[model samples]
Target: MNLINKKVTHKRFGMGSIVKQNDSIVEINFATDNKKFVYPDVFGEHLELHDASIAHSLHQIIQEKVLEQKEEEMKKEEEIKLQRKYQELRLGHEKLMRNHKLHPESQMVFWCDAEEQNSSLSEWKIFSGEIKSGNNKGKPNKPIRLHQNSAVLLTAVEPGRPEEDRRILGVYMVKDGFIGKLCEDGYIPAHSEYRLQLTEQESDQMLFWNYYVNEKFPQKQTWNTGKYRYFDNSWMAQILRDIVALKNDTREQEQAQQFFDHHCKMNQLIEQDLPKPNGSLMRA
Candidate 1:
């Protein structure tokens, strides 16, 4: 429109000298000694652009640039939001590990289900009980002992599966005061040998084992006995180290100490309530 460096009249500002012109906007110096920038498409009718073809071309370019800018800004905002969400998730994971008192140095056992009946990893449950003194020909052997606060590296045997890989189920810390005789509690069927119980929180966490499983130990290792057992060899050690660091960072050691202290107190109380050989109450 050759409006650049030309005198023109703005509908509102009145009688202004065009100082600059670009694809998107035109800047003008008003007679009142004020400066204003106007978008051509928005104020094209209000001002004069002598060349109609030039005005149309500039308008299209301006529209395109504006759309591009909006898209770029939106992308940046999304990136920022994603980064923030990740940080929150990391913090939440650390807090969870601490609350459970999970640590790498703690003694842990690898528990797995190999039976064809228990094919689904989601249905696996750990058992604890003493085996019957005499070997019952058809009965399943029960654990002789189980302890509260025990940690286990859990897994399910995967043989001929599509992935052909054993998955590492996340670590679990046994709940406090949940250990007892399977036969006495009646929590499960009489034939079932495990008496250990997990809290609702612990049970729900198990559902997300796929998310928690250590990815570093992708390959499966086998421990062969009468049957083939598959497990992630490095998963337990790696997860322990990671959780230990999380617990320390979250300052959960103090909470852990208090838990043990209370546990000891409860044990003492139980011992005191026990009857002596002579049938007298035992001293605390």
Candidate 2:
């Protein structure tokens, strides 16, 4: 915006006409002498344009800049909070690693069939299981294979893209015995722990093939056909480690905090407290 030759008023300088204008500075010709001031900065506080239309336009621009600055500050504060949470969680995870070992008495990896890339990563409140062999075979069933309080690492493969690589989506811990009913929706755990869901960026880095491959045929990925596969403590530990590494390498603090919050809860789990898998029946 050019202000050259425009009349202006300074609170102290009384009256003046803008003699020159530059990107950052504006000069004015006061009755007594010439004066210079910072552009825009002086308009709202130290000076005002004499023309009503131009003055209104400048006022709107100034208001917009102020609003943008406030938003930027708020964003910075939120990022700081996330960083603080991350540091606290990092310390907690270190203590857990030092004092405990992996427990997979019933831990398993679950694969969700999805078409959209982030379908499995959505705010999931229930998960469907498959009936291995029965009249209603391949239909949604309760998670009969999971023991109460066991950890389940969730993965996903887009439907019709079996040949493409899969991605690890999230993790969940089951609640006490079978709490779901025979409904079309799916099963619901009494509680989900370390309920971590990967962001799109995080999922890209956690390809299923990159972590778990067939032992005999190093080139082949495991869990080729099954919806769920039991994974031992070693596999569980590997997944946990990879998750921690991924969180540390990303700048998305809000997403990382969700993982850290639930991850710390995992430290409190005790193997003996978990119920043995007894193939309990779902509610009628």
Candidate 3:
């Protein structure tokens, strides 16, 4: 119902809400800087649902900045931590070199297929009473914000669109009072999500890929020239190949990997999802 902090999420908006409802999109404030943003998209799953306490903690981490007087305190703590980590790495590297470890230069590099999402768990599971089987039921009647002076949690997705795939992640009470839900923690098919936090750049890549893939496919029966004109573009083709790889169909891993291999190579996976929006297709 409400978000106490400002967080970057995979939605059109980046901040969280304190009092949220279907029509109360204007009630949100971003923890990033105490600024406010409101829009039509805010009515959707602005954040994922998990636990309320964790969500509150995440909010505190984002909205509550370290005070100027506390800066030196944190700085000193960070300096000690860096010194320990650096020493550990240095000692390990020395041991490897001294022992004639044959590790390849390329082997030292790391590759992570997963992106990050920012999410939390819930304390209070808020929901609306059952609606008539066929009525619109309209939206929630209240501000949709939960009162949690305790722990909280939330869920979120990575920034990726049609062409790209992203995994979600969730965290615990990383900060303090947070409650979360998409449309007040209740939607037709809303699911509890876990999120992985990522940089803005990574988030941009995800959004770009999602748009490219969705516009080209849009969950249709097939991909055809009538629906997507850009599929014929060479750059699009190249990007897919560069970031995705192939695996045997029966030797499956996960949907994300499968998609990466298919379109990331040939854009073969989503061809069927693209169709004429008018619903006049051969299959139909």
Candidate 4:
């Protein structure tokens, strides 16, 4: 191939430009602090040219690459914007749900957890009771009014991770309503029990919880009083809307994957052109 001044990805050195070439050897300058010379015929196996659109002066190619990166960033920003918009719409719907009176038999419950163990929805279980009247007192004692098959949605905090890492864990159908009773051990306090059964078909794993907290439901104080928190219809409706948005963003997600794959290919070409510690060319 005609290798003079071409942008290529090296299997070892990452992205680089073919600065010079002779009858037997091709010279490449990598993005990293390395340069290499390789046999013209052998170089083809180890290096792949970038998109033909980048076939310009190194300076021009760099500029084009920067523009491409900016475009990708803009796409991500648009996704966030859409997420915020849907979140707002969900909140509004929630308010409407709250204003309307619910049937006396059914009530909605909100559940929150730190998810330190990264437990999946299937793994979650109904605990027997909580620690009684101590610093470790469990979820608050609110009136249990949920009917069988009532809705239960979960949100989780990702411990030691960024706030963005926090997400909605998904919805669970209450197989059994709150069965309030004291534990056999008096030291362990009584708690209202509910069997949270997962409905995988209706859940969204991509909806973030922190986004809702920051943009939709801002709280005045730290509200971590054990794993479960309760909310009414408005909050549940908002979560369902978020799920719908996530499911519908399939096209954007596919585009993102394509962008990421292109980036990886570029890096690999540059890396393949890197020189070894002994100042020898890496083998194809």
Candidate of highest TM-score: 2
Pairs in clash, predicted candidate 2: none
lDDT of the candidates, in the order given:
0.42, 0.62, 0.32, 0.45
RMSD of each: 18.5, 16.3, 31.0, 29.6
What C-alpha lDDT, on a 0 to 100 scale, does residue 189 get in candidate 2? 48
Regions of candidate 3 where Cα sits further than 4 Å from its true position: 1-199, 208-255, 259-284
TM-score of each: 0.34, 0.42, 0.17, 0.32
For candidate 3, give the lDDT of residue 23.
Answer: 37
Candidate 4 wrong stretches, greater than 4 Å = 1-120, 128-131, 134-143, 162-165, 176-221, 248-284
Reference-based lDDT, residue 108, model 4: 35
Per-candidate clash tally:
2, 0, 53, 15
Candidate 1 vs candidate 3: the TM-score winner is: 1
Q: Backbone clash tally for model 3? A: 53
Return the lDDT, model 2, position 207.
66
The candidate scoring highest on lDDT is 2
The candidates, ranked best first by lDDT, are 2, 4, 1, 3
